[model samples]
Target: MTEEGDQEEQTILTWARNYAKKHHWVLNPDEKKLGIVIRGLARNKQKYGEQYCPCRLRSGDKEKDAAIICPCIYHEEEVEKDGSCHCRLYFRKDALSE
Candidate 1:
């Protein structure tokens, strides 16, 4: 993935972390004094280059394309194509009041 893509993914993950914290969800197992909640998710990276999967990009299903595509590419979840959906693993930090 490109630098831009990595940055974007991090940004989204941050939001998810905050969202889970707001809902009092145990995103991470460890805890700290400041109580800065953290959320984590597994991301899939295929070994084969010729293989294709949603991990390359969200294609709205069709992830189980080929065995060469590797297994468990990004926590597979059905996201809406409405254009505004941040995705199931996504959460906007500003979604809740600070």
Candidate 2:
């Protein structure tokens, strides 16, 4: 949500650089939006589900390591991140129950 020349944009870059340090994953190509983005292949199911994991290193919390608080990332507070246009973000219980 920052304009090109705005200082807030610069601040966002600082945040982005920190996000990049999280892992070795490179920025994905479909990434034309504002922040850092990563991409990978994922399976889908009819019912969409989302969750936020502890990997998101928000400012100030002692447990820095990743935790399995939630299984999927939602786009609102989170949303199912896009892998490719063809893939839907969900898991079928019958298929997932394995």
Candidate 3:
């Protein structure tokens, strides 16, 4: 990865970490998984100009696609019910022990 890519990924990771803190959640405990998700987010931000969810397909509609960006509209419910979001990025604190 180029230095630019590295920087972008770091920025995303920081944002994600802060977001998780605010929500009282945690990032995926697996470092490999966390890196993958961060890379995906960075790639999307570079390619489509938005941090689209790596685990989902985009509809090609900006307004509709906005819902799938990094902190997607579905994340809360997913975390609340499944312990983690679909992308496995954000997890409930207790979920890590399972």
Top-TM-score structure, candidate number = 3
For candidate 3, lDDT tens digit of each residue in 40-93?
999999999999999999999999999999799999999999999999999999
lDDT of each: 0.34, 0.27, 0.97
lDDT of 3 at 81: 100
> What's the lDDT of the predicted structure labeled candidate 1?
0.34
Tens-digit lDDT track of model 2 for 1-98: 22523444354345434543443222222334323221111101111121123234333332432232122233122221332111122222232233
TM-score, candidate number 2 = 0.26
TM-score of each: 0.31, 0.26, 0.97
Provide the lowest-lDDT 10-residue window in model 1: 33-42
lDDT of 1 by residue, 1-98 (tens): 56754564465456556755664432322244112211112223222223233334434354444432312233222221221112223222342222
Per-prediction CA RMSD (Å): 11.5, 13.9, 0.6
Q: Residue 54 of candidate 3: its Cα lDDT?
A: 96
Predicted structure with the largest lDDT when compared to the true one: 3
